[model samples]
Target chain A: MILDPDLPLIDRILAGEQNVFAELINRHKQYAYTIAVKILQNRPEAEEAAQDAFIKAYQNLAGFNRQARFSTWLYRIVFNTSISYKRKNNKVFQSIENTVIVYNHEGEVSLEKTDKTRYLNQAMMKLNEADRTALTLFYLDEFSLDEIADITGMQANTVKVRIHRARQRLADELKILLNHEALTL
Target chain B: MNRLSQAQEDILLEYLDGTLAAPAKIKLEEELRVNALLRLRLDELRAVHTIFQHASLAEPSRDFTARVMQKLDTAPSPTPSRWPIRNAIFLLIGVLTAIGAAALLIASGVFDGSTSISLNDSSLPQKIIQQEIPVFTFSGKLIINIIIMLNIVVGWILLDRAILRPYFQRRMQA
Candidate 1:
């Protein structure tokens, strides 16, 4: 039968091949962690949330209907778990000045890129969690609008609006941040 | 240059995403040719896109996958029937015990009209003030009734938490 690769693994797991689940975990962990980090904005918490999500996926494997791709379902779990962690922690964003970005001994362009990346991260913190997550998944170029809607529990139209609005706001924030930097120097 | 409207900015974004229809794309291109401000806005949005293109996924710790596998091995299967069923059994037992005790007390006549407690019956208040305090007497039957009512409420809550909610959650998932 023609099934997505994950469906076979899922069938095997359902048939009592438990260790086969590890391959599933390895296949999906990066995007899962990325979704977590985007929502939680804390590396340690994101890691914990991602790990918890994988465990949750494993536990609920029996109930996973194959209507959606496995990655979509798993990322939804990651998104929800990260959101719950974010709520539990109620963490404030770290100050931009305190953020550290390390690059190898490249040239001045790398230094400038690092600074821009740092400023972008700071600008991202200014957004509310939903907006940050919406923009992040949009830019990741991995999921379609429908998949993003499923992951974030937003409507497709809403996700579209949010992505545009978030991008516009990020542009404004980046402009302000760069202008402030120029003034300080 | 005049500030662009929100609609205008949305059009620019749509154009950038290449989702603008051919007619609208032609119209926007015509506008961009004459309008420096719209072009400038497009450039700013393009810059944001460029920055995002440079963005990459943050890698989890080296052991992230291993950690997930380890956790999967150790964590119990989150079946609605397993832990929640056990918890429901314990709560049911507790509720049954409470109802049984209340029934036993009632059958033994411990809550009969003759048995009661009074606040003024204590000697400490009289020893301190040597005055007749207002007597607040409650019958054992009343206290037992209140206790039973409270137990019923608490038992309902426990049963809901332990059983009904989990059962329905699994049903919805299915």
Candidate 2:
């Protein structure tokens, strides 16, 4: 049975049950890791950021206002922690302008499945950080635009615009790759 | 045909994702049927959306969970000590109580009177006057008077050192 982390885990953690903290970690680790990876884009750093986020969550558990959902609060921590990790490492997020459109060198017009997937991944990596985050939350996590806005601390309309722009950019990049391969062929 | 506005494009994307409401979905479908450019844009967006949906989920390192658990194990356990605000309040009340008690005692003449008494046995009237009202001196008095004054001052100093100073220090710390 899938455990309902929102119910007993929060109450137990607040009641000084330290072991329950581990349960909280186990339950939200994937969600936290996904957010961290989306922002930081590196597995090790994402792991570190996720761990730090959990520690901060544990430390500030007493101050958590129950008005917001626990998952919302936790996502806020994960997002902030990932941003801080990026800042500390001095790694500039891959911006849309800086994206390199890699194409297959051989003059092959037909697209292989792997090449299309690679092209798509590369295009995703080129998107603006906000767009990338919005798309990841919306498509991969199956979050609604409202939920994406909540996690991203942006308006729903803003998230909608971002996702639209990101999709357009991806399509444009794919078209460019496809044309470049066609020319070579 | 008017080009699809950014909002309309967003609606189309949402419709493709099956997130649009029924009325909005119908409206967008009607528009898509008439607008060739909007149809092309919708197809492109659908292609990108499909790719995004199928993108590989990046798995964390092999030791990801173990590392996270280890970090939690090593993290400083929240000590859950008494809140500084509560401690400060308790110390403030204690200091205020000590000050109030001291003020009450000083105002009530508990420590204001002298310790030594002078007696005049030479004349009956003087003796009666001395008996009726004693002329007291806290300084240059009898041994017992000096001892009593010393004891009062010593007691006050001890109380200030043992209680008042510590209370104030604790309040400041808080």
Candidate 3:
């Protein structure tokens, strides 16, 4: 059987050792935030949503059945929280400006890298939230299709289609952007 | 050299992901050798895939864990507690007991028109109380009816609190 590191921490929290939950939060915060950011596309809102999701996970610690991995459960919570936050706030697509790849002023390599990153970000923002999130999670290489499906509340086949479609759209957008850059150059 | 079909694109994606079987990979490679447009499309898809491959997890603010812990200190526990329902039930019982006592009083004729005391027959002087106390001629039945109505309202609210609200909330969660 596969061993889960978070299982022990979860048990401690369930047994009333509340402080250990901090370690659990720290361990999973990056991924949880990643999921939130993928869905919300806004850093501050994504942060809030991720924190709320952690608090929710903590509160519902006792109800967490160990059948699923802790990360999966936490991500699902993050996904739902971010989606609800998006709906409740009625936020327009906010740029994930902070998470963009930083460009070094080295030479032509850096310039092309920067352009590709910018094009990818713009293209990502153009797709609907589900497609963007699915593509992000799939390419993050941190989750399987099934885990992504669980986090997204979609069937695995649906997620596959979404990722496929999203990638195609991103390629099309990047082609236009790069072609424009080539023309300008 | 025309635009690739959806199936061809999917196959190229699977090839890029290293999931295409050997025969399909061989077939795709042969097509790519002959078709410049198809190869260009693959190059475009590869670039997009590379961008995603470089996508890193976004970290939260430096004090995110601290903020979450602070919030947790104030947030209520997540276990579905029955205490509110229990408290409502206790309150309903108290209200019912009060209504029952009022009903008993009605049954015992305590509020009957003939049962009031007179101030003129008191130990105090007439100068202190110039007028005799009027008999309480208000109908006992009316008082009972008002009490019953109030009790019904209270009972409905308590039932909603103790039962219906929790039930519906659970249903919504489910």
Chain B alone, TM-score, model 2: 0.42
Question: Best-fitting candidate, measured by DockQ?
Answer: 3
Which residue pairs clash within candidate 2? none
* Candidate 3 chain A minimal-lDDT segment of 10 residues: A98-107
Alpha-carbon TM-score of each model against the true structure: 0.66, 0.63, 0.67
Per-residue lDDT of candidate 3, residues A30-115 (tens digit): 98898788777778989999999999998888667555678888988988898899888763433223234222212335455456
**Chain A TM-score per candidate?**
0.85, 0.80, 0.84
Pick by TM-score: which candidate is best?
Answer: 3
Output the number of the lDDT-best candidate.
3
CAPRI classification of candidate 3: acceptable
Worst 10 residues of 2 chain B by lDDT: B139-148
Which of the two, 1 or 2, has more TM-score? Answer: 1
TM-score, cand. 3: 0.67
Candidate 3's DockQ: 0.28
Estimate, for each residue in B56-167, the C-alpha lDDT of model 2 and write its tens digit: 5556566665666666676666554446445655655565565566556666767754565656433556534644555666732244345545555655665665566546
How do the candidates rank by TM-score, highest first?
3, 1, 2
What's the residue-level lDDT of B26 in candidate 2? 88
